[model samples]
Target: MLSSLIFLLGLPLALVAEPPTCTPLIPVTFDNATIPRLLGHWIYITGASKYGPHLAELKELKHAVFDLFPGSHEDELNVTEIMRMNETCVTRNTSKIQVFWHNSTLVHADDQVTSMAELIQSDKDLLILKHFNNNFPGLSLSARTPNVSKERLEEFKTHLHCLGFTEDEVFFTSEKDACPLPGEKTGEGSTEPQPE
Candidate 1:
């Protein structure tokens, strides 16, 4: 009779579903020595997320280029995002990052944590980032140029599967007009398309 009672209690515990596991997540940048090497210009390629809003934002994102600069404080980074939306070159220069040990994250000036970043793969030319947020995790693939290779993209999909993300949630960036740099005199997205 006692054994029957124990079995009944254990059944409830077994019925509870366990949270999904994402593994084999190797670090792309681990220590201070390796972190510095990741800083530079990067072109946004594609992103995948289960969050509705984040996925929507990614879908709307045609193309983006960003520069990672050293901040006033150590282990901090200043990220300037450059994109073109509706013939308008939109540039945002306030996002800051606080690089941490192990897995790092993007932070704000107020010290508010934005999104946790995990590097999955980087071949100098291609990079993959997995972001673990409050309730949603997102994966991003970047490259030196918008033109990415088929192998890299396939690898990204494999990582996405491990994260429990679906192909429907993936958003591919459409490379187009790029915004001018700080002091470049070109109507990057201001005028009509030029002839070939």
Candidate 2:
């Protein structure tokens, strides 16, 4: 009789575990109309490998920009570009990212332009990207970004923690504001598209 009572109590306790929290969710999203300041220019990035979850550092960002699309109202649509670092899958590492921006209007630009960019989305706090088999489809690889406000960064870090990533697994550097490349210039009509 005592053992039966213990089992009943323990069963309730086992079934009442708290739901996990999303802590490490990076605040970076493609939906904000206000373009991010870090758009354009390359950024140095390091993060946990998506496949192995092992830490890896990627080469400099090839490009980062934010493009825009006008809405029927005054609102605009935002599409973020997350750079894929490897030409082919390597360790299924986290994608080497160069976050950029473009609008739905520019989706079918010349091959030269489209080849240089791709679209991504952030649902809730999960960062997702597009993938193609016969055609482009959703590739929602649960991800975390270091490029965000400290508060948001902590939140995302919590999410990462839930996903088994330690604090040392993720790192990033924004090169957009660093000293300009030789002869590089900013302001209107620059080659680099500003984040929207």
Candidate 3:
């Protein structure tokens, strides 16, 4: 009887373990040649899956339909894109996508990320993007991938310079570990596949 009580008491402690903290990957610059490929549609999962919403969007891409979550809005907001052109060129990249707010929604999305003023200096493999915002914690939704290339990334650097963003203002994440998949949500308005 004493052993049973001990086991029951210890079970609660074991179950109270803290969840693993995300190893936040730093942000990279536009010079990374792989940036363009990473800019387009990507399979993203958060907390548990980095590719959750991303994979579903990919399946839709094969059907030639690109859909952004929460639909469209007419207000200023932030967005992220994971573009893909060829299977082999499925590299990871990040861009500070923006949308203008109007009537409580975003009307248009902007790809002018001002942070990446300098060229990428490392030869890493993965890319990570974190939106720096102080008001209204932004939703890390998927973005409509941009059709950028090597020349395009270079061109973008000048564009950022024109926009007045300096080199040090930008940041890059280390290219280690597997790119995570978007996790599955289990409540109303969740991105899980529902019955037809």
Candidate 4:
């Protein structure tokens, strides 16, 4: 009878889901990310995330490009993201990002929700960003150029492993044609043909 009772009590414990694990390295913000230097274009090289809006779907993403511009407010930036879907369709999104420097780190916010990312390392050519939320840990590598060199890619992979991510969880992206210039009609919602 005691054995049966213990088994019954263990059933609920087995059903309870365990919390997700995260890397120990905290996100570090760069103090030198000036507005002018951050502006212009950047291409996505690779990224890994366990949870987010489209974490799984992003694995299939072919290409992504970002264009940063000055915002109306001095502390804000206008960000445009062009993402290629399945090598056929491209999607464009725009958001206003508010940034603040605090505790020697940079915090980014959109619509009042804040996300912190550490600038693990960066230079004139490449930028490494690492973010760890309770259940949403992510790492991304970007470059000024569309195509990054193999050596650079290998360095990024090393950083990924250092952040507790496995090779299978990470995916790389390529650069296609540059995103259309601002306000030239993206046909965002319609079935119109996208630019090649």
On TM-score, the candidate that comes out on top is 1
Model 2 C-alpha lDDT versus the unseen true structure: 0.35
Model 1 RMSD in Å is: 9.1
Q: Which lDDT tens digits does candidate 1 get at residues 1-196? A: 9999999989888778553345576766566655566678889888887666566667667777887788888778888878755455567777887777644544334232356676765687766777766678888888877778787787777778777878787777666556566667665335332211
- Give lDDT per model, in order: 0.70, 0.35, 0.29, 0.65
Q: For model 3, how does the per-residue alpha-carbon lDDT over 26-104 read when each residue is reduced to its tens digit?
A: 2343332333333334333210112333324333331111223332332212243322222211222222233322211
Candidate 4: residue 67 lDDT (0-100) = 75
Query: Candidates ranked by lDDT, best first?
Result: 1, 4, 2, 3
Give the TM-score of each candidate.
Answer: 0.72, 0.31, 0.25, 0.66
Q: Tens-digit lDDT track for model 4 on 18-52?
A: 43343354444535555566788888888897766
Candidate 1: give the clashing pairs.
none
Q: What's the lDDT of the predicted structure labeled candidate 4?
A: 0.65
Give the least accurate 10-residue stretch of model 3, judged by summed lDDT: 134-143
Rank by TM-score (best first): 1, 4, 2, 3
Error of 2 at 26 (Å): 12
Show model 3 residue runs off by greater than 4 Å.
1-12, 39-129, 139-196
Candidate with the larger lDDT of 2 and 4: 4
- Tell me each candidate's RMSD, in Å, in order: 9.1, 11.4, 17.9, 10.3
lDDT of 1 at 19: 38
Displacement of the residue 153 alpha carbon in candidate 4, Å: 1.4
lDDT: the better of candidates 1 and 4: 1
